[model samples]
Target chain A: MLAAARQLLVREGPGAITHQRVAQEAGVGRATAYRHWPQPDQLLLDAMGGADLPLFKDPSAPIRTWLHRQLRQMADELEVRAVAAMALTLAHSALWDPAIAHRQAESVRTIIERILVATRSAVASGELETEISAVDVAAMLVGPIVYRTTMQQGTVADDLIDRLLDSIGTWRD
Target chain B: MLAAARQLLVREGPGAITHQRVAQEAGVGRATAYRHWPQPDQLLLDAMGGADLPLFKDPSAPIRTWLHRQLRQMADELEVRAVAAMALTLAHSALWDPAIAHRQAESVRTIIERILVATRSAVASGELETEISAVDVAAMLVGPIVYRTTMQQGTVADDLIDRLLDSIGTWRD
Candidate 1:
C-alpha cells in the first residue's frame, strides 16, 4: 500500500495523492488505506523511509574508490533527473515546513558522517597524507556530485568520477 | 516596475502576479504595465535576470577572490531558509513546465561559464595548476555552496569558502 502510494506520488505528484486514489491504485479497500495512513504526507514519508534499500558496504575499500562506486550506484538507482527534480521540490517545500527541513538537514549530516567514517579508516591505514577533518572532505566530495546532478541536468558519468578520484587520490600521503 | 513585480512574485508567489496588482504595486496604470510587458512570464523572467538591478560587478578581482565574494554574497542574500524554500518550489514547478526547465538549465550554464572564465584567468597567471580543467574546478566551487544552502539549510560561511580555496590552492603542478 505504501509502495503504491509512493508510485502515485512520484508519477502524478503530491496533489494527485489521496486516500481514494491510493486505494484504487493499490487494489485495497478505501477503508483499509485510510486505516493505515490517514494522511498522504504520512504515507509518502513512510514510503521514503521504509524501502529496504542496500546499505553502505564494508569500510575496507579505498575511500575514493568506495565513494565513487557509492555515488554511481545512487545516481543510477535514483535516476539523476528524478533526484534532481525531487530535490528541488523538497528544497522549496522545506522552507515552510520545519519537519521537512529537519529531515533534509539530518540526511545531509548522515551522508557526511558516512564519508567521515570512510576517511578515518583510510587515515588509520596511512593511505592519505593530509590530515584534513572528515567534515571538510565530505563537503568536497559532495560539491561536485550535487553541482553536476542539479545544475548540469545529467548524471555524474563514471569517467568524471574517475577523474575526481585521480585528482583527490594524489593528496594521499 | 520589474522590481515591483519581482517583490510581488517573491512575497505572494507566481499566482498573484496579475497585471492590475503589479501596476498598483509599481504605481503605474494597468494599461502601462500591459503595454510594457504583454506577458507575465516575460516580466518574471526579466526580473529574475537581474535586468533592473546593478548587481554585476567588474571582473577585475582575482578569480579566487571574486568567487569567494560571490558565494558569500549569494549565501547572505538568499539566506539559508529562503534558499531551501525557493529551491524546493522551483524544483517542483520545473518538472511540469518545459519553459521553466529550460530557463533553469541556461541559468546554471551561464553561472558555470562565468566561473570557468575566472578560473582560466587564474590558471593563465600560473596561480592555479593547468592540469585540472576550469569546468571541474567550477563544479567543485559551486556544488557545496548549493548543497549547503538548499539541503542543509546552512550558511555558506566565509570559513567554508576559505577552506575550499586552501585545498584547491595546494593542487600546484
Candidate 2:
C-alpha cells in the first residue's frame, strides 16, 4: 500500500521502499504488492505524491501574502521526514530514461499549475502585475525553494519570497 | 578507476555504479576497486566530482558578466551525457545514511565555495548589493538552474539569469 511505502520512506529512507518491505508492512503478499506497483520507484513516486503537506490557505488575503504564506508553510513541512523522501525523489529522478524524466517533469508541472491558478487570481484581484506568464512566476517562486532544499541549507528565508515577488515585477493596485 | 565509474554512470545510471562494474570497466579486479573505494557511494562521489566541468574564466571582466558566463557554461555542459551521471549522483544521494549525506554535503560545499568567491568579487566591485550574504546570492544563482535541471527542463531561460541578478538587488557601479 502507498501508506506502507510512505512510512518506509519516512522511517528508513528511499532504499527501504522495496516492494517486499512495503508488502510486509501492509500485511499483503509480495505478489500482491508487485501486482499493483511493479518497481520500487513507482511505489516511491506514489508515496511522495501522497505526502500530506499543507496547501494554499486564506484565499481572501492579498495574493502576495497568500503566496508567501503558502511558501512558508511548505518550508515548515520540509523540516520533517517528508522532505527527505521528496528530496530523494527529486535528486534520483535523473535515471537517464526519457520516460522517467518526462514523468518527473509532468509531476512538477502539476505543482506549478497549482501556483498558477492562485497567481492568476492575484492578477485579476489587482494584487500583482507582471510581464512574465503565470507559469514563469510560479517557477520564480518554487525554483529557489527546491534549490535551497537540495543544498540541505534547511531554510527558505523570508526575504527570498520578497525578492522572488519583486523580480516578478509586482505592482500596487 | 574514477574514469570507469564515470563511464558507467554516463552509460547507465546511478544504480549501475557498483564496484564490480567500475572494476570491469577499468580492466581491474573487483577486489582492487574495493580496496580503493570500499563503498559504492564513495565511487559515485568520485565519479561525479571528476566530471570535466568548465570553470570560471576571465575574472578581470566585470564580475556580473563573468558570473553569468560561468552559469551559462554550466548550463551548456548540462546538455551532455555528463548530466545523466551528475543527476544520478544528486538524486540517489539520499540513501538514508546520515554519514553518506554528511559526506555528500561536504562535497557540495566545495562547489558552493567556488560560487561564493565570484559573488564576493561582484559585491566588492559594487556591481551587486544586497542585504543577503554572498553565500545566499550564490544560491540564488544556482538554485534555478538546479530546479530546471532536476525537472528535466532542457533550458534555463536567459531572462532567468537576468531576473536572478535583479532580485539580488544588482546595481550600476
Candidate 3:
C-alpha cells in the first residue's frame, strides 16, 4: 500500500495520492489501501518520512566541508523537477496544516542541530577560530542553500559550496 | 501617478494595483490611467523602478557594513505585512514574465555589484586578506537574507548580520 502511494505521489504529486489511485497503482483493493492509510496527506507524509535517505556521513569534518556536502545533497534532491515542485507546494500548504508545519519546522531544526553539533566539534578542535555562536554558523551555512533552492530554482554549484566553506572556515576571532 | 501606484503596491499588494484602483487612488480618471499605462504590471514595475522610493539607498559605510544595512532594511520591509506579500507575489510572477524576470535578476546583480565595489576597495586598502571573488562573497552575504525572508518569513536580526559579516570578512586570504 505504501509502495503504491509512493508511486502515485512521485508521479502525480501530493494532490493525486488518493486511496483509489494508490490501490490501482499497487494492484490492490481500494479498501486495503484505505485500511492501511486513512488520509492522503498522512500517507504522503509517511512515505516521505519512511524513505531510506542518506544520513549525515562526515560528522567530524570541518564545519564548512560538512555543510557543503549536506547542502549539495539537499540541493540535488530539491533540483529534481518533480520533487522541487512538490516541495514548494508542500511548503506553501504547510501554512495551513499545523501537522505539516510542525513537521517541516522539525525537519529544518534537525538539519540546523546537525550543523551546530559539527560546529561545536570544530570549535573544540580549535579548527574554527571565532567568537561566533554555533547556531549562527549553522544558520549561515543553511541560509544560502535554502535561498538558492527555493528562490533560484536550481542546485547550488560545487564552486558555490567551496566558496561557502572557505568563507566560514576563515572566520577570525 | 507613479507615487500613487507605488502606494497602492506597497500597501495593498500586486492584485490591488489595478488600473481602476490606481486611477482612483491617484485622483485621475480610469481612461486616463489606462491611456497612460495600459498594463498594471508595467505601472507597478515603473513605480518600483522610480527613484523616490526608499528601496534604493546609497550607503556611505564600508562594503560589509553597507551590505548588512541594506539587508536589514530589506528585512524590515519584509516584516511589513503588505509589502512582504507584494514583493513575494512579484517574485513568483517573475517566473512567467520575461521582462520581470530580467528586472529581478538585474536587481540582484546590482546589489551584488555594490558589494563587489566595497570588497575591491577593502582589498586595495589592505583591510581584507583573502583573494575570494567578490561575486561569491556577494552571494554568501545576500543568500542568507533572501532565504530568511522568503523561506523562514523571519527578519535577519542584527546578530545574524554581524555573524555573516564576520564570517565573510575572514575569507579575505
Candidate 4:
C-alpha cells in the first residue's frame, strides 16, 4: 500500500493520493486503505519519507567533492519529469499542511547537519567564509538547482556547480 | 469574479479557486461564473497573470542597484505568508497544467530578458563573468531567497543580498 502511494505520488503528483485511488492502485479494498490511513496527508508523509531518492551521500568525504556529488545527484534526480514534479508537489503541499512542513523540515535539517559536518574543518581552518551559516551555505548550493529544475524547468548545467562555488568563494580546485 | 478568484488564490492557495467558491466569494451566481470560465484552470491562469505583485521593476536601472532592489522587493513580498504560499501553489500547478506553465514561462522569460539587459554592459566590459548565462545569474541570485522564504519559512536576512552577490561575484557593493 505504501509502495502504491509512493508510485501514485511520483507519477501523478499529490492530487491523486486519496484513499479510494490508492486502494484501487494497490489492488486493495477501499475500506482497508481507509483503515490504514484515515487521512491522505498521513499516507503522503509516509510515502515521501520512504521514497528511495538518495541524496548527500558520504557526508564525511572532502567538502568540495561531497558538495559536487550531491549537486550532480540532484540534477540527475530532477532530470526525471515525475521526480521533479513530485518535488514541486511536496513543496506546494508543505505550505498548507503543518505535518508535511514538519516532515520536510526534519529532512532539510538532516541535510543541513550533513553540510555542516563537511564544512566544519574548512571553517576551522579559515578555508570557508566564517560569517556564513550552514543554512546559508545550503541555500546557496541547493537553491539554484531547485530554481532551475522546479521553477524554470531547465536542466542543471555542468558549469552551474563551479559558478555557485565561485560565487560562494569556497573550495576552489 | 477574477478579483475574487485572485483573493481566494492568494489567501488560501490554488485549491480554493473553484468556480462555485469564486462565485460565492464574488457574490455572483455560480452559473455566471461557470459561463465565463468553463474550466478552473482558465480562472487560475487569469488570476495569476493579473496579480499586481510587482517585481523586476526599472530594469533599465544600473545593473547592481537594480538587481539588489529586485532581491529586496522579492524578500518583502515573500515575507507575506499568503503570497509565498501562492507562489508555491502556482509553481506546483504549473507542473500539471500546460496553460499555467505557458503563462508562467512568459513571465519568467520577461524577467530573464530584464536580467540580460542589465548585465549586457557588464558582460561586455568584463565586469561580470562572460561565461554565465542570464538565467544562471537569475537562478543564483533569486534561488536563495525563494529557498529561505518558501521552503525554510525563514526571513531573508539583510546580509543575504550581499552574500548572494558575493556568490555570483557580481556587484559587490
Candidate 5:
C-alpha cells in the first residue's frame, strides 16, 4: 500500500494520492486501503516517511570531506523523482497546518542532527571552528544545496560545495 | 479574479483556488473566470505573479548593510501568509512539470537579479569582495532565511544576518 502511494506520488503529484487510486495500484480493495489509512494526509505522510534516503556514510572522515560527500549525496537524491515529490508534499502541506509543520520539522531535525555529530566531532578534534550553533551551520551548508536544487530547480555543481565550505569559517592548522 | 485567487491561496492553500470558488469569491461569473483562466495552473500563476512583494528599498547602501536589510525584508515578508503560500505553490508545482519549472525560474531570477545589482555595485565600489558569482552569494545569504522560515518553520534571528555577512568574505576597513 505504501509502495503504491509512493509510486503515485512519484508519477503524479500529491493530488493523485487517493485511497481509491492507491488501492487500485496496489491490487487491493479500496475498503482495505481506507481501513488501514483513513486519512489522506496520513497515507501520504506514511509513504513519504518510509521513503528515507540513505544518509552520508562514514561520519568519521575529515569535516570538510564529510560535508562535501554528504551534500553531494543530498544533491543526487533530490534528483530522484520520489524524493523530490516527497519533499514537495511535505513542504506544501507543512505551511498550511501546524500539525504538518511539526512532522516536517521532525524529518528535517533528524537530518540536521546527523550533521551536528560530524561538526561536534570536528570541533572536538580541533579540525573546525565556529561560533554558530550546529543548526545554523547545517542551514549554511545544507541550505544552499536545497536552494540550488529544489528552489532554483538547478543542480549543485561540485565547486559549489567547496565555495560553501570556504564561506562557512572553517579553520586550518 | 486574481485578488480572489490570492485570497483563496492565503486562506486555504492551492486546493481552494478553483474557478468556481475564485469566481464566487470575486463575485464574478464562473464563465468569466473560466474564460480568463481555463487552466488551474494558469490562474495560480497569474494570481501569484500579481502578488509580488516589494523588493528592498535602497540598493545603494554598503554591501553588508544592503544584504542585511534585504534579507530582513525577505524574512519579514515570508511571514506574510500570502507570500509563503505563493512560494509553496510555485515550489510544489515546479517539481512535477518542466513547464512550471521554467516559470518558477523566471520569478526567482528577477529577485536574484536585484541582488546582483547590489553586489555588482559593491564590487565596483570596493565595499565587498567575492570570487563567487552573484547567484551563489545570494544563495548563501538568502538561502538560510528560506531554510529557516519555510523549511524549518522558524523565524530568522537578526544575528543570522550578521553571521551570513561575516561568512561571505565581505571586506571591511
Candidate 6:
C-alpha cells in the first residue's frame, strides 16, 4: 500500500489519488486500499517520511555556494509538477486547520533549527549581518522563493540570491 | 449573486461556494447565478475586490514605524477567520495552478514595486542598509512574515519584527 501510495504521488500528482485509483494502480481490492489508508493526505505523509532532501555538504565550499545550492534544491522541489500539485491540495485541505497547524509546528521548528545551524557559522565568519536571528535569515532566504512559487511560479531569477548577499556586503566567491 | 457569494465565502469559506448555495442564499434561481457567473472563480474574484487591507501609511513616520504598522495590519488580516478561511481555499484551488500564477505575477510585481519605493526613501534617509536594492529590502520584510503565516498559521509574534529590525540596524524610536 505504501509503495503504491508513493508511486501514485510521484507519478500522477496528489489530485489523482482517489481510493479507487489507488486500488486500481496498486492492483488491490478497493476495500483494502481504504482500510489501509483512509485518505490521500495520510498516505502522502507516509510517503514523505522516507523521501530524501538534498543535504547540505562540502563545508569547504563558500557559504554563498552552499546557500545557493540549498535554494536550487528547493526550487527543484517547488517546480516538480507532482509535488506542487499535491502540496497545493494539502494546503487547501487540512494544512491550515488549527489541529494540523498545532501538530506540524514541531516539525517546522525542527526544519528551522537545521537552517539556524548552518547560518550560525555564516554569522560567525561575517558572511551574514549580525543582530538578526538565524531564524529571520532563514525566513529571508526562503520567503521570496515561496512567494514566487505560489504567487508566480518559477519567477525567481538566478541573480536574486547573489544580489541579496551583495547588498549585505557578504557576497564573495 | 455576488453578495450571496461573499456571504458564503465569509461564512462558510470558499469551498462552500457553489452555484446552488449562492442561488439559495440570494433567493435567486440557479440559472440566474450560472448566467451571471459561468464559473465560481469569477464570483469569488468579485467578492474579494473590496477586502480592506492594512495599507502602508504615514509618509512622515519613521520607516520602522511604518513597517511595523503595516505588519500589524497583515497580522490582523491573517487573524480574521473568514479572510484566512477563503484564502486557504483559493490557494489550493487555483493560486498554485499555472494560469493563476501567470496572471498574479504582475500584481505581485506591483506590490513589490510599492515596497521598493518605500525602501528607496528609507535608504536615502539612512534608515535602511545601503547597496541592496529596495527589492531585496522588501523581500527581507515580507519573507519571514509569509513563512510564518503559511507554515504555522498566525505565528508572527509581536516582538519578532522588532527583533529583525534591531538585528538589521533598522530599529529606531
Strongest candidate by DockQ: 4
Q: Is the docking of candidate 4 incorrect, acceptable, medium or high quality?
A: medium
Candidate order, lDDT descending:
4, 5, 2, 3, 1, 6
RMSD of each: 7.4, 7.5, 7.1, 7.2, 7.8, 8.2
DockQ for all models, in order? 0.44, 0.39, 0.29, 0.57, 0.43, 0.30
What TM-score would candidate 3 get against the native? 0.65
- Please give the distance, in angstroms, between residue A135's alpha carbon in candidate 5 and its true position after superposition: 1.5
iRMS of every model, one decimal? 2.7, 2.3, 2.8, 1.0, 1.7, 3.6
- Scoring model 5 with DockQ, what do you get? 0.43
The segments of candidate 5 whose C-alpha lies over 4 angstroms from its true place after superposition are A1-47, A51-53, A56-58, A96-102, B1-47, B51-53, B56-58, B96-102
Sum up the clashes in candidate 4.
1
- Expressed as tens digits, the lDDT of each residue in A83-168 for candidate 3 is 55445545555555777667666665666666667767777877676555545555566667655664554467887776666555
Per-candidate fnat, comma-separated: 0.69, 0.55, 0.32, 0.65, 0.52, 0.47
What's each prediction's TM-score? 0.69, 0.68, 0.65, 0.73, 0.72, 0.60
Q: Candidate 1 clashing pairs? A: A88-B88, A91-B88, A92-B85, A92-B88, A92-B89, A128-A173, A129-A173
Candidate 2 residue spans exceeding 4 A from truth? A1-45, A50-60, A90-103, B1-45, B50-58, B81-85, B94-103
Per-structure clash totals for the candidates: 7, 2, 4, 1, 0, 0
Candidate 6 deviant stretches above 4 angstroms: A1-46, A49-52, A55-64, A80-82, A96-107, A121-131, A163-173, B1-47, B52-54, B57-61, B79-85, B96-107, B120-137, B162-173
TM-score of 6: 0.60
The alpha-carbon deviation from the true structure for residue A75 of candidate 6, after best TM-score superposition, in angstroms, is 2.3
Give the runs in model 1 whose Cα sits over 4 Å from its true position.
A3-46, A52-57, A162-173, B3-46, B49-57, B166-173
Candidate 5 versus truth, CA RMSD in Å, comes to: 7.8
lDDT of 5 by residue, B51-97 (tens): 54346434866767777877887787665555566567778877667
Q: Give the fraction of native contacts in model 1.
A: 0.69
The CA lDDT at A57 in model 3 is 35
Ten residues in sequence with the least summed lDDT for candidate 4 chain B: B52-61
Model 5 residue pairs with clashes:
none
TM-score, chain A only, candidate 4, equals: 0.68
- Residue-by-residue lDDT tens digits, candidate 6, A1-173: 66776677556544455678878888999999878877655666556544332334333336777777777666566665555555555555554465545445554565567666666667667666555454555565666666556644544556766543443334433
For candidate 1, the per-residue lDDT at B86 reads 46
